[model samples]
Target: MAVVAVSAGIMPDGYGSDRCWLNYDRGFIWSFLGPVCCILGINAVLFIIILILLRTALSQMQHGPAHDKLIKMVVFKTLVQSVIVGLPWILGFFTRSSQALDVVFHVLNSQQGTFIFLLHCVLNEEVRKQFRSCCRRMTNKE
Candidate 1:
């Protein structure tokens, strides 16, 4: 593979005439598609694990507002995590077929870090409480 890669170089050719990759034609299969498949597979396994854990936990918990809220929060967070992390990579597959999809992929891929930060911090209850505490302290000092 290394020898072939050295000979082929990273120049665009054949089907990938516009964009370059490790090889070009089949490079996407090995380089891009392989990793994407691994990531998606891992996500699928994790989601299954989460469902199993949730069922056990839910069965043990008593029915109440707190229990309901916990269920909603966990479900919502899991969904958001899946979409934010998975959607862009999924879109990447069809990006070559559609200009709009390509643009959407780029947008989502570029802001992945920001999206995660927002998910973990801005949307987090503990982070929100800390933010509120800091704001109150600053305002009281003034």
Candidate 2:
């Protein structure tokens, strides 16, 4: 994919040929820095803060299996969300360095929603219950 993009003239050669907001010199902030910092960095920081808050709250709240399970789920979801929503943008910085990395970045960056769906739907007990219920209903109907 990276090679195809490069061959098709889709990937900029870092030579400023296309000349747009993405041309490092012309609009570096608008194209890269702004989105990367705002979206990726902030999401990471926010998730960290959420985990800290959850930890403190858990220490204060009554200790029980339910509380622990909820906290575990929240922490897992937060970590997963942060990584999927944020970290891949960091790859944008290195996309210019290697074709392999560039293709990896594009693949990971584009699959954020798919990753979330797998996390929340396939792995989530609540969603699985709903799926089972729907299946049971269809079976009964037949």
Candidate 3:
């Protein structure tokens, strides 16, 4: 799917035609929107699947203490992260390309990595312990 989208991007409608190709300059909609839409579509489908699985898990754990709260927290976090990561790109579709927008877009774009790392490691008890243990082991070795 990615290969197809990339191929489509590289060989857009105007490619190889001197009159319209313009030296392979990919237009905004083709280069950005196409891939962005494809990725967002894929993510949406995956999110639906995740919700289904989470629903099943919740149903199974209905009697367990605090499981419901944990499930809600997970869902809320997922939704918030999705909005944070996706909102800028979606808004970019409407806003014109400007320095301000570029800065905003890049900032939002770069935050995903940091956010994911913090979410998965810093806020996660198991990962935080493992990270600290690795740090201790390295220091001890040194």
Q: Candidates sorted by lDDT, descending order?
A: 1, 2, 3
Q: How many residue pairs collide in each prediction?
A: 0, 0, 0
Q: Tens digits of per-residue lDDT for model 1 on 39-93? A: 8999989998998899799869999999998888888888888898899999988
Model 2, span 11-129: residue lDDT tens: 35433446333456544334445545776667767777888898998889888999889888878888887778766778767777788888888899899999999988998999999
Q: Which stretches of candidate 1 lie above 4 Å from their native place?
A: 1-17, 22-28
TM match of model 2 to true structure:
0.74
Residues 2-66 of candidate 3: C-alpha lDDT, one tens digit per residue: 75567667665543455322223546245546677888888889888988888888788756557
Cα RMSD (Å) between model 2 and the true structure?
A: 7.4
CA displacement after TM-score superposition, residue 127 of candidate 2 (Å): 1.1
Error of 2 at 142 (Å): 0.5
Best by lDDT: 1
TM-score leaderboard ranking: 1, 2, 3
**Candidate 3 positional error at 104, Å:** 1.3
